[model samples]
Target: MEPPRDAKLLDPTTQPARIRAMYTDPDFVRRGLGRAILARCEGAARAAGFRSVEMMATLAGEPLYQACGYAAIAPVRSAPVEGVTVPLIRMGKWL
Candidate 1:
């Protein structure tokens, strides 16, 4: 997906790596599984010379991202789907 139009990054010209569609099964919640996945992704991004990472987070996932050191970088945006809207926050972290 393209970067958000109103993204405010440390380097606007440098496109940060993106993480998408991350989730943990309800049965596996609180098992540190999500954090492990995020660590691996961040490691790979850093290995590839990326200085940062970003993702559009659902309200349910926002707490985890914040706990992992990602901060909100933009205002909440609505994603329309089948006549419904999902609130998403643009969050990012420097590697």
Candidate 2:
């Protein structure tokens, strides 16, 4: 069974590893699941001796990541999703 929320730690193909495919079930959002998942991902990175972690954030998720200590690393960028376009921000945090 899937957990109430989810986060994935991407292997470090680049200098600092990246996080991708993170999400919380709508009903469970803001109830700490997302934070817990983010913490788990960071913990794993630290355990693996990584210096930092990075992720691309959808507009809706930017604030949450900011609260988790991720800083915007670049200007907002747009990408197509489904049939519409949305903004994304690149963010990074030291482990």
Candidate 3:
């Protein structure tokens, strides 16, 4: 059966939506590639008419994103992974 429209994980009203997955490759990350990528994404979101953008962050990534203006909106919860319950932060920024 097909999933309900709203059941899709993304926000539909966020037109021209963009998704990015970033990591600091040893050669790229330490030199500020991640920050540059985030800045580009935010600019693209604004140009696309998105009022905001959202991201889920692992504990290690939280500080970086926060420093770049993303704010925590809520704490993430889910069933255990590998017998260890993990937590994540739901973060967002206005474009």
The candidate that achieves the highest TM-score relative to the unseen native structure: 1
**Model 2, span 1-95: residue lDDT tens:** 33353356545545676788899888888799989989999998888878899998988889999999999998675555555666788999987
Q: TM-scores, in order shown?
A: 0.82, 0.77, 0.69
- How do all the candidates rank in terms of lDDT, highest first? 1, 2, 3
Each model's RMSD to truth, in Å? 5.1, 6.4, 4.5
Q: On a 0 to 100 scale, what is the lDDT of residue 20 in model 3?
A: 49
Say which prediction, candidate 1 or candidate 2, comes out ahead on TM-score.
1
Query: How many clashes in each structure?
Result: 0, 0, 0
- Whole-model Cα lDDT per candidate? 0.87, 0.83, 0.73
Alpha-carbon deviation at 16 in model 2, angstroms = 0.9
Any runs in candidate 1 off by more than 4 Å, and if so which? 1-13
Would you list the rank order by TM-score, best first? 1, 2, 3
Q: Return model 2's CA RMSD, one decimal.
A: 6.4
Q: Using lDDT as the measure, which candidate wins?
A: 1
Off by more than 4 A, model 2: 1-14, 76-83
> What is the Å distance of residue 13 in model 3 from its true position?
5.3
lDDT of 3 by residue, 1-95 (tens): 33444544545365334444566776665578789888988887777667888877767789989999988879986457567766778788776
Model 3 misplaced stretches (Cα beyond 4 Å): 1-20, 78-85
TM-score comparison, 2 vs 3, better candidate: 2
- Alpha-carbon shift of residue 6 in model 1 (angstroms): 18
